[model samples]
Target: MSAKVQWFAKDLLIIGAGFAAAMHIGKLPAAIPILQAELGLSLVQSGLLLSCIQCAGICFALLIGSYVSKLGLKRCVLLGLSLLTLASICAGLTQSVLSLFSMRIIEGFGFLLVTLSGPALIRELAPIQSLPAKMGLWAAYMGGGVGIALITAPMLIQSWSWSVVWFSYALITLSFLIGIAWFIPNTTPSSQAVPLKSLIKLTLQHQPAWLLALIFGTYAGQWFASVGFLPTIYEQNHIAPTLAGLLTASVSIANAVGTFICGLLLQRGLQAKLLVILGFVVLIACALLFYTAKDSLPFMLQYVLVFGFSLFGGLVAGSIFAQALHFAPSPMAISTTVGMILQCSALSQFLLPPSIALLVSSTGTWLWVGVLMSVLSILGIVLTQRLFAIQPKTSA
Candidate 1:
């Protein structure tokens, strides 16, 4: 195949991987309640499912970060999709949290494989000048998949059962795996493969990478804490229980829109630092409205506040990921850096939901949750904008 044709083929395969990953985010909400009730699990137990996904990512990213240059993208993605299929089916069949954890060990690694290679794959398939734009679209589509899953999964579970949720996601994984097997182009010329040796570099160990990791992690923790518990909160408020599905799903859609906007602006010379700064600004506004004005606001406005806050919040999740790819020391190192960032984000995903649940279980109001979001947002802003003179740009 011609170089252009080969690159486009590989791009499609990468896109399929992203679609599969995005769907996993949507699958969690529906699974949480079912797992809690089915296995007599606590909110903490449910939170670990997310933890497993990130855990695998963290470990694998370090081991395999630069492996793309050696193993090639097609082989790595094939392995992940196969594992993803197995994990989804296993998670669907398992009756206990123990079984779920066992299966998630597989799922988490699969996710890591997919994510760590994402930016590297894009770089291989697209021109150097198009990296930001391509990564942005990739982020949008991935976020959109999460949105689609959020909207669809709840209604299915409402009518069916929790097992159906996992099975359904399994189907998505299976289909994507097949597509990837059929169409992902072979690995093209590698730019620079980041070696594990450089991981020992003190400058990387110290400043920009870790600090940026924390910023992403904190922002994600606050956002997930809110999203993970939203269903229960909806139930508590006696609003439509489906509102959780609608809201989470819609926010995903909004996030996609935001990411897309960011991609467009980035192409026009928008700064990554500015986007991070603006994200915190929006999060602060959301916290104030969510805390102080929440009760007084009408239902529509409530939706608007949640949606608006989440739109930018979701943007942070995707765009930061894209940025990680951008700053990657080399193609081979994509997994290492992206894995670290995802690990931090995933740690936040693991910890915050249970923390918020415990607090709310004791305190009985979302008031303090708002305070948490505000604080995290401020911290993220400080950390992201620190030392780096360029302002992080926001997606739309």
Candidate 2:
């Protein structure tokens, strides 16, 4: 990569690790069709499979934060990547649905570790001037990785199988582990252990912490629920699988594009909260146009609207990451704050996909998905205002 691309070397490493982990996460949605065929998974089971990797985060984000802070970020990153490497390798060897579910749960723990610790690592290593831009890029990890995976998985699976895709991810994660070790400077793990009760008390005591977490959750719920099912949704409309994957991938990349723009805006000193509110406005408008007007409009128009929803909807993520740095109670509390947000985001991931799947399964249409997304966007708008109400305090 060019030095301009690696503006912050260590930050780039952390983002690279995150991108690989996200690819592991994103690989699943594209492979869902093959897994369903091979494993005989029901609609709910498919949704569960899509989200099961978040199960550990849902339950242990806060607790993991405390532990990771004690263990150190580098150690956490290595350990998490190792687990994913192993879990993906095992998943490639498995054929049974039960085995796949169990492996995903393991991957869940791995995903949680990298993501929760990554921002804190970036905050430590990044130059002051570059933090906002780096964080904005950090926010795009999921969308970018998922977008790439969505585009590539179909092509890979057509020649081979889902297991091969899983194996390829394992190799990729292993390569990242080696890169992180070689290129990233090492830091000693903290000996100090913040008591669990104290950590929770400190994080929960802050109002911005709660609001940030809620905002992240609501934003992530809509994003994941919609994107996770896009390929399937298009399939039902009789789009070719390759074409569907391409379109879905493009939508996700649009999210990353918006995130990149938002990052540049943050770097230029834009009001972070205002960006989030604008994002929610775009999300609501796009949802109305895409989800509600699908049947009435031409298919390509529907596609364009969904693309717009994701493109602007991405500003929420970038804004949230920017605000999160300011909202952190202290430098030490950054991981904790991130954990709390991820916990909320993970819970949304766990709940929203299955919930959306059930809605589609029960109602037999994508009509109400827009309504759910609209409600969440409205909630996000209300919550965004509260984020700016409190003057951000300096965290040591």
Candidate 3:
């Protein structure tokens, strides 16, 4: 193969690994009903299952990132994929909720390793001119992985069982693990290892990194809360499992499309700040219309609103990931900065969905969920403005 083709192939492999890792997350929403019936789980317990995959990210993303930098990105990615493969298989065998939840927590660690390392590795591999577009593609991994899993898991579950879904994902992750090991070049670690304390200081001291963290956190929380529960929401409305999965998958795939477009726009010299602000505006409008007007509006219109919300939310994510490369204090700190952002993003994902579930349970309404999302979307707009104010003059 040509050298250019080789480079592109390696980048694709890394992104594929990320997508495989995310399938562990997407597989659960489709299985929630089966789990509730088979395991006798409560709605609160189901919410926990959905959010617990972020546990390691909530607590250890920065530490993992610091060590990943010292360990070499290729090695960390391999180790991450291995963990995911193992965890998925183990989760498939579990007969109790506690055992399954424990395995999911391990999956979170694996997810952290791949996601934190993938972008930094891409920055090292891609030409400067192609970096933004590549990062945008990297940003699409979650939505793409989740969308495919949502669509396929239901079919797998109906044909067999939820355990089959888990086992299938394990096999898929293993395939990517082997492909990455064979195709990607070994990444060398830095000559000197930075201490965890220093890595945290370097990442936390950068104002733009913190702003990016908050912006990503708000967007991720709202997006996950809305999209993650979509299957359950549709199920409550008496929608068939197959159709619900398709609708939810459509929303997620729209997010992937938005992120890819955001990348192209960024490469063409569109301002990241403008894209982010536009994303927030669309999110706010969508949240109000979808959550508040559900009974009055046509079902298709409601789906359109949420689909738009996710698509524009992808624009926010792609812009943030692209800009993060510019704001890192040093080459070694790239993963650290991304980790800090992921930590906050994980924090939001951890907190938001369960909170929404509990509120809906208590009040018998989804209205406050819209209010919460609007508040966060406004916060995202303010943070995006402040983040750009401090953008390094040399940034593209």
Predictions: Cα RMSD each: 4.1, 2.5, 2.1
Pick the winner on lDDT between candidates 2 and 3.
3
> Which of 1 and 2 is the better model by TM-score?
2
- Which number leads on lDDT? 3
For model 1, residues 32-119, the per-residue Cα lDDT tens digits are: 7777777888976766665666676555555565455567776777777778788888888878678888887887777777766776
Cα lDDT, all candidates: 0.70, 0.84, 0.87
**Alpha-carbon error at 320 in model 2, in Å?**
0.6
Per-model TM values vs. the true structure: 0.84, 0.92, 0.94
Ranking by TM-score: 3, 2, 1
lDDT of 2 by residue, 45-154 (tens): 98778777888888899888867777788989999999999999999998788989999999989988998889888877887788888888988888898888888777
The alpha-carbon lDDT assigned to residue 256 of candidate 3 equals 88
lDDT pick, better of 1 and 2: 2
Q: Candidate 1 at residue 239, lDDT?
A: 75
- Candidates ranked by lDDT, best first? 3, 2, 1
